[model samples]
Target: MTVNDKLQADWEPKSDAVQRDQRAAYDEMRERCPVAYSDFLEWSVFRHEDIVRVLMDPDTFSNAASRHLSVPDGMDPPEHTEYRRMIVQYFQPERVDAFEPQCREIAAKRLQSLLGRDELEFIGDFAHWFAVRIQSASLGWPLEMCEPLRLWTQKNHQATFAQDRPAMAEIAKEFEGYVHELLQIRRAAGAQASDDITGSLLRQYVQGRPLRDEEIVSIVRNWTVGEVGTISAALGILVHYLAQHPDLQQQLRTQPSLLPAAIDEILRIYGPLVSNRRITTRPVEIGGRKIAAGERISLIWISANRDGRVFEDPEAYRLDRDPTANLLYGAGIHVCPGAPLARMEMRVAMEEILGHTTRIDPIPERPPTGAVYPGSGFATLPLRVR
Candidate 1:
């Protein structure tokens, strides 16, 4: 059945109540209505078990939720397999290790600038720039593209939240234009094109055929959005949490080696990503709710990771929890291929921040603003760093 045929709102996803505190709101939903239907988000699966069921049974719940070309992200099975293979190679262990030094340099430089300030809006001043810089550097994009890309990410979030299809289409076109120009330059340069990730993609092939310009744009768009939006939100959540829990902050500061695990745990507690989309290929019953074929389903990562059934003391910060249970990078075939890169980036950034400063405390008068639906973490994180 089509969206219009659906009746009875189970919950309002875009409501002020949910947007005010998404984690709490999702936690309530997990217990109240694990599988719910609404106009905004048709079927939101909030329980850990239900989401895991969806992730594992991709045949029943398809990832092809978008009409636009989304490369592997919007594909399934045989098609998804080939493109996923090509995407994973770019983020192999060796490649991620090679990029660490540059990532550290970017983090260190950004941290140095903010060290002198007594108080600053962390998201705008530091987090966003770090995400944008590292993403551009990794892709070998021109330095001039950084600001525009940052602005584009912001606009993309706004468009998504508003569910403004026309604005989203325009934003997508804007990104395509940037990527197409880069591809054109690389093609014109031929052998002289810098041997970077972007250049490497130009040489990549799929199904015994060269990738088209639109495909390349789609891939790059996915990477950029994933990197910029999620990383920025993750950083805000990490620093904000550290500022609140001084004990964990000091622990991580002394034992920098524990950063990788700590970052994962913290992100799991307050997921950087709000939700991932999936469409039911056929009718399926989950959490005692019967969802029709072709129904839109959203796996609420924020809710699933915090479910007390799977995670004991769901709100508490503990590094000893089972890593396998954490859905920070997700699970199953569609798990984030860039998990390694994201982990490295977050680890390095946290290390630099903790090493550089003695304290990261929240401002008493100005509390950090929680980011609304379609966004995670702080909208403006005001903190004192010294």
Candidate 2:
């Protein structure tokens, strides 16, 4: 709350305009102030080039932006590399491949409950439900944990946006309790423990030492809450995007193989996750703004993915665009390790929806509600499923 910092504020991220339309606001901000400042998010980097620079050079823009432990995603250098290698096996091709049938089963069951309905609220009724169920099933969690995890994701987002450190800490501790209980269950089971991801984590070792409970909790938090939030938002965005774009929807329905590529492209155009935080290790200039060492900044993913400089006619949908340029799963050492599982979950969920229904159309009377900062996609998506 220094005078200089207050004076540097460029735009209000939670303004009415942004709340109404996040994409349009981000597009305008990226153009007007590529390196904007705000009280909420110290310095916001909106351009694709600047974000790519930040990602490629993690040494300069460190990912240890949180005060709490964040497993591999929020660590730096040597430490991140070690933890990353240990946990990546959970998302190996074989593991994710084995889970595909189960993922489809979860999606199908949710759809079956609403099969006869003409109109539905996709966000609450389907998107969040499916996201939580899939995450729970992946971890061998009981069906009862789904509702709690879904609610935890919501509360986590609220505390994050409000910058309520105490509330955030409380929820963090709550998540730790959940993980602790699960770990204890596995431990008690001994030789009969279910060999799921959660059980596997209890047996993981790092740097010649068994992984501590705190470390295990951090890892599960990154995988569960993070994936649940993003995957839910992503599914909502995909369904809403297809409903608005009939040509693409129909094309995908006919050429089902294109869904894998189509899902990434749609999410690129309308990102599910908003931004990631990084801190400066040394003074540097990005977008002509000089940032001092120890300063925190946000790389706006929603804006960066749609930067016209990188993707020609960035807003337009196209399959031919270069995949490497897209920062969907991010770039560099901190890139999302669970991308394989996430990709499979989304593809399977979308395939089930499209395969079972002939059309997904928007209800004229009930427009989708745009999620606020720190959360992307719709909060309430009312659509006609036929």
Candidate 3:
């Protein structure tokens, strides 16, 4: 192959067809070009085993892929370990269980609002609403912050997809502004500050010193992004999946206890978060393709989890599938610290949805629109609920 041919993009991740249907596009890339490159994502890793190799060897493939600070998500080794240890406290079983009542309450309130509305756009009306509400409650933020946070997430996604450096920097600054205001409020309160997660972060110390304001903001920013963006997309995907599959929907409704496993399996079939970034720490060959040191990598989660080699009949929903192999919340040391909270939120949301509604069907005239690139799941999901 010529030098130009070897270096040229094997596939366009941001192309129109791929954006319309990412899972299918990634499936094609996995077979046709397992280690594809594009200007947008640099190197896109498709297969399950190859992605797993990258995940297992964080030293070789670093999580510090972005130029901006991502708190624990962008960190590795001793630094990642220290911050992750502190961040994980918020998602512990007890903490998650403690937040359950409130999560259900938020879901119930949302469902109540949708009552009697048979046909509605589920994305804005419910998914984003519930995600932000639950996130606000968990972080001790006022309900007033939900709309702004949701809007911020949308802008963040747009900037990320376009790779607009200036906009992304401004967006990051805007998020930091939101976080700073919260910090100031708690700092103003002194000893009387509410004993919630945000307040807890203020008190948290790392590396033998109290957390700085920027670090705290970065931490909260990561949490909010995961909670608001990923969870909202995931809810849309889950509800849309159920609306399309009558038998699975019926089964889930009949056995309410199965919602958690059903939720995982369904999400596995159609993942929410699209891809995560990694950078090659040294010259490495992935899937027989030589990648130079300092090159960027994109681990396509939606594609990796659905790999036919690792998963027999990958598209088929199976509660019996190996849980260990699923990269939904990711793998290795950088595995999402908020996974427990996310799973709980999804389960609670589904339980509330299924328990309240007798059926869920998609609106034929208004087919669900798929979210593109950095986002996953339906951008607009019109569902008929009864």
* Model 1 C-alpha lDDT per residue in residues 1-386, reported as the tens digit of each score: 56437568889999999999999899999999898888898889999999999999989999999889998898899899999999999899999999999999999988888788899899999999999999999999988999999999999999999999999999999999999999999999999999998888989999998899999999999999889999999999999999999988998899999899889988999999999899999988899988789989999999999999999999888888989999888899999999999999999999999999999999989998999878899999999988
User: Model 2 segments beyond 4 Å from truth?
Assistant: 1-7
Instruction: Judge candidate 1 against the unseen true structure and give its global Cα lDDT, from 0 to 1.
Output: 0.92
lDDT of 3 by residue, 1-386 (tens): 42234587788888999999998998899999999888777889999999999999999999998787779899888899999998888888999999999899889988988878979899999999888888888999988998888899899989988989999999999989988999899999999999999888999999999999999989888888888989999999999988999888999888988888888888888989888989988889989899888888999998898899999999998888989999999988988888998999999999999989989998888898989878889889999999
RMSD of 3: 1.7
RMSD vs true structure, all candidates: 1.0, 1.3, 1.7
Best by TM-score: 1
For candidate 2, the lDDT comes to: 0.91
Report the C-alpha lDDT of model 2 over 1-386, residue by residue, as the tens digit.
53345465799888888878889998999999999888888899999999999999999999999888889888997999999999889889999999999999989988988979999999999899998999899989989998889999999999987889999999999998998998999999999999998898888889999899999888889888678889999999999999999989999999989999999999999999999999999989999988888889999999999999999999889999999999999998888888999999999999999988999999998888889878999999999988
lDDT agreement with native, every candidate: 0.92, 0.91, 0.89
Measured with C-alpha atoms, the lDDT of residue 143 in candidate 2 is 91
RMSD of candidate 2 to the truth, in angstroms, is: 1.3
Better of 1 and 3 by TM-score: 1
What's the lDDT for residue 351 in model 2? 94
